[model samples]
Target: MTEMVKGYNFAFIDEYAKREIRRKVLKAVSIPGYQVPFGSRELPIARGWGTGGLQITLSLIGQKDILKIIDQGSDDSVNAVNIKRFIEATTGVFITSDTLKATIIQTRHRIPEEELGDDQILVLQVPYPEPLRIVEPEEKETRRMHAEMDYAKIWVFLYENIVKWKEITIGARYPVMVAGRYIMDPSPIPRYDVPRLNNARTLYLFGAGREKRIYAVPPFTEVKPLEFEDHRFRIENFKGKACELCASTDTFLDEIILDDKRMYTCSDTSFCKKRGNNPRVLKYIDRNQQ
Candidate 1:
């Protein structure tokens, strides 16, 4: 067997990739909600494991900034923990559990419960940022179509979803009105996090590495969720169950599989640990350790 290493790898990504990402981030910060093209490089982390988020974090993180990463809104989740560990190893910057203390938050799937201020920046990992992806699969066609503001196809698509499903089949990643013209994707932050976007003081940025696109929402930017007069934009139904750990009725809960029975449960063990400190997460930790 190989001997144990003395320290962690200093290379999460190369300098060239970090510089390219930094350039894209600068453009994104300058032009809100505009998709800027960048030459994205391959990283050690896989595509689905928040590589985009990690890129943004590496580019933006200074020695002064405190970073917080959460997957499904839990800092202790394996994905979140892994990302956090990677950053901590590379940058040696602070890692925070408190939302308010974090200068930058890298999130997947769910947004934090705490309201972010103007000082904070949120970096979202987007699997697919295009709202018209379902309607128009061709990248070349969609780019030209977006340039012309030809979203007639998207409206028809939504209309058809209603016609067939009786309701919009989109669970998360619901489309939103940006600057009263562009219909943008809120990066799958759950519909609950969509409302938090409107007129918020924080800068929201979206990154999709595989798609090679980055977009932004400026502070106090106009963000209106897509809705009909008869059918309003709503969050995923939890069926009136509080978080098993935090007893929070307001936050989103992850669906659990227990003995083939479905149940809604909180996946944020950090949040749960703050409350009565649920034992399930602890048990999971113990099992993993063993």
Candidate 2:
């Protein structure tokens, strides 16, 4: 574990603020997909960048907790790197890029390819909290819809997409019905990550600082992506495509153009290295503990 920076609290935020966030989190988990409002405290970072997810991480994190931060599945991205550095300096918690090694994983726009264990907690940074915003612009009306379980507007939106595009045109941030009650935007994670949210062992938490909403999908909870009988929801097909580096066929691949040719690579770079039997990533350990 890194030493906590001087003059800062264990997790940077005051105890009272952490307690309040914890209370909100409890309510969020209990309700399952209900967007519980909280006092989203201003962090050193900008609000839209990841203040929501960072607040939750700081609030729930412990000295012993091992953390992993990823942006769009890349560990070394600018956003991920900066957040990891900030968290490490503030909390003195151990950081790992290896998905399985992290007790709490904070991610923006992607879920790791590896299955998180029951002990793991996944904190997702949410830019938008309302799935009904596309259909209904008003918050009062959206809340009413959620209260009444009225999702007809969203259903129609999907239907219209199918009619116009011959398929559900939503590329990312696909809406899902959690526990058959509330429709939720599962961050901006790709359609490939949608099905992984259903009945997962790990608890999923969503925080939107700009929106001041925190929601959750507890382990084993039902999370069904919105679909129609005729136009069933499907994941992005990468048939005959494999990650160039890892030769992985199952994981989510990011398309890139190199030398005027299309190439696909694993989005989760650490996982890709692991697949290639690279010890560079796996060698990252809690040096203090070791």
Candidate 3:
């Protein structure tokens, strides 16, 4: 067991791989929203299953950094638990379910409901980094289009969506124009979380292992979702629904079906737990009463 453990570095990845990733991360940060290419190493995990986010986490993590891993807003999910355990075993870093206590957060699908501070960093797992992939399959052509800021095709696609669906049919992975310069996918985060990425206090990094790309949204960067002037960008509307457990209306809720009875609960478990014990719940209740 001791000999097997000695075969791998602190994060199971070698120091050279970490340094290369760090260098690419710096470049990604320097030019926010620009997808920097890197040599993605094969981990014990499979690709298309969060190898990108895992690589990023393993590279940037330190002994002092408090890491939090979440999948679809739940830390207790299978993917989250596995990644958390892997990181803990390798780096010996303190792991936390509390969003506020986490220095580094690796998330898939959902962003935390609570506001992230400037000190925090969010690493998103991206299956695809290119927003124009649906429009153009060839990567070289897409790169050219991005270089010339030729998003006319994308705009036309959005226009078509309005004409066909009466609303932007993109449920998630909505494309956004980042920093008024480059167009980005913002990963697979829901449209509700897209607004949170705009001018965010925390640094938002995205990694796509299969795609071999890394992108970033630095603090205070602009991130405008693609939409026509007539058809503005919108988020998922719960239609007057509130979490059954927390009784909070101002949070993203997951619909729960128990015994054919539909109910809503906060998608973010840590945020829900915190808000349940917080006095702010009283304020929310009082405001509703008035």
Stretches of candidate 2 off by over 4 Å are: 1-4, 278-290
Query: What residue runs in model 1 are displaced by over 4 Å at the alpha carbon?
Result: 1-17, 260-263, 275-290
Return the lDDT, model 3, position 75. 97
Model 1 lDDT tens row, 1-290: 12223353433566677788888888876766668888866666788678776777777788899888998888888988887877776767788887778999999987776667779999999888788898999988988877888888887887788889888888889888887767788887788778888888888888887777888888998899878787787777776688665676666677787897766656554555555553332311233455
Error of 1 at 10 (Å): 6.9
Worst 10 residues of 3 by lDDT: 281-290
lDDT of each: 0.77, 0.92, 0.88
Cα error, candidate 1, residue 204 (Å): 1.0
Task: Please give, for residues 167-238, the per-residue lDDT of candidate 3 as tens digits.
Answer: 877889999988888999888888889999988889999999999999999999998998878889999899
| Whole-structure CA lDDT of model 2 | 0.92
lDDT of 2 by residue, 1-290 (tens): 44557898888999999999999999999999999999999998898999999999999999999999999999999999989988998987889998999999999999998878889999999999999999999999999999999999999999999889898888999999999889999999999999999998899999999999999999999999999888788999999999899788888999999898999999998899898885334322344755
Comparison by TM-score, 1 against 2, better one: 2
Query: Clashing residue pairs in candidate 3, if any?
Result: none
Alpha-carbon RMSD to native, per candidate: 7.1, 4.6, 4.0
